[model samples]
Structure formats: C-alpha cells, structure tokens
Target: MNTVEWSETLLLDFPPMDEVHHTFVDLLALAQAAPDETLPQAWSAVIDHTVRHFGNEDDWMRRTRFAAADNHIMQHKVVLNVMREGLGLARAGNMAAVREMAGELAVWFAKHTQTLDAALALHMRSVQSDAPARRTNRANEHPVSAP
Candidate 1:
C-alpha cells in the first residue's frame, strides 16, 4: 500500500483541522494495513472518519461563506461515494478494490490537503481574525509548527 506520510508540509497551522487530518492519516494507514479478514471494518472506520472530517470542513465553509464552498463540498461528496462503493466491493470479498482505493487515496489526500484543505484552513484563520467572536478558539490547542 502506498501510505501517506504525515509531515510538516501538511500542517495547516490550525489545531482542530490538524488534529482531524492527523486522525485521517492514521485511519488511512489502518485501512491500508488491514488484513483481508478485517479490511471491511478498517475501511468502515475510514469512511466514518472521512464523513466527520468532511462535515467539519463543510461547517467551517458555511460559517465563513467560503467562495469555493460548492466545489469543495462536491469534491467531498464524490470521494465519499467512491469510498462507499469500495467498501461495498470489499464486503463482497473484493479486498483488492479497497487496497487499491487506499493507495489512490494516499495520492489524493496529499494533493487535497496541500490545496483545498490548506485553503480552507487559511480561510478559517482569516475569518477568525476578521471576527474573533465567531470563530472557536482552537488555534492554540494543537501547537503544530507551521509550514
């Protein structure tokens, strides 16, 4: 499996988002390493984490009135649908599909984090600075080094 290697380059400098993203990377690794008999459950956990992760970002977009909201949400939806399909295939004993998806996801995840998610994190910070009361105070919670 082509696993995503979490690195300083992936940091968004936002605690909540970074925490979720770290969990995402870990979950993806779990899915990638899952044995054939346990792939279904591992993949399911990834799906669950992904839904929550996407939902959190969607909420941030809605709150901040992000200009690329529609496109971002659409991307999330499409990816989730494909993941769900892969889960189904895995349940049907097509573990290869899930493994393949995990590899593709490693590639997709690095690109997505560098682009879309990075933008969102910046936007959220901008929103926080522009309206301190509207944004939750999570910036100091994770203490990750910024890129």
Candidate 2:
C-alpha cells in the first residue's frame, strides 16, 4: 500500500493543531502498511491518537467558547463512530473494508480541516494570538535540522 501523506498547505496555521493533524496522517499511513495480523494493533494506535487529538480540539473550542463548538464536537463523534466500526471490520481481516475506511478518513480530514478547523483556527487567532506567537517563536528557536 502506498503511504498516505498530508502537505503543509493543508495546515490550519496553528502549530499544535497542525502537528496533531500531521501525526494523524502518519498514523493512518502506519495503519495502511501494517500486515493483516498486526492490523488491529495499528488501528488501535490510530484510534487512540484520533481520540486524543479530537479531545484536545474540543477542549480548545470549549475554553474559547467558539460559536460552532457543538457542531464540530458532533462531527468528531460521528467520525469516531465510523472509525470504530471500520476497526471492527479490519479486525475481522476485511481488507476491502479497511481500504474503504482509509479513503473515507482521508476525505473527512480534508473536509474537516477546510471547514471546521479553518473556522476554529480563525477564531483562535482572533482570541488567542499570543499562544500562536509563543509557539512560533519556540519552533523558530529550536528548529529541527534534518539529520
């Protein structure tokens, strides 16, 4: 299977959120590469990371009182449910089902980032500019030079 990749252009311009988004894509790539026998473990890791990322986003939205927080949270719930059901199929060794799930995940991430995350990122910038400034400064100061 080809590795799934996300480009920097898709980032929401928020350091923490962008990092988590990239991690999610990486996890998806790992899941796609896992052998049938190890698929369950790989899927579990993806689910765990997804849940954590969603939770972090939810917390930020709630703390900031973003207007569409409820809607975004609801979308997260739907995605999680879909992922759980897909994991069940993967655990049963259904390769076709897993592939379908991966496709759905990729589409969902694209839409979610463009719509929901874009809105959140804008609101966050308006309300939390200081946080991003600090994050950008830290990232600049400790650039991870390629090995």
Largest lDDT belongs to which candidate?
A: 1
What is the C-alpha lDDT profile of model 2 across 60-101, one tens digit per residue?
888777899999999999999988988899878796787768
lDDT of each: 0.87, 0.82
Give the number of the best model, judged by TM-score. Answer: 1
What lDDT tens digits, residue by residue, belong to model 1 across residues 6-63? Answer: 7888899988899999999999888898899999999999999999999989988876
Tell me the alpha-carbon RMSD of every candidate: 6.5, 7.7
Q: Per-residue lDDT for 78 in model 2?
A: 95
Displacement of residue 136 (Cα, Å) in model 2 is: 23
Model 2 lDDT, residue 111, Cα: 80
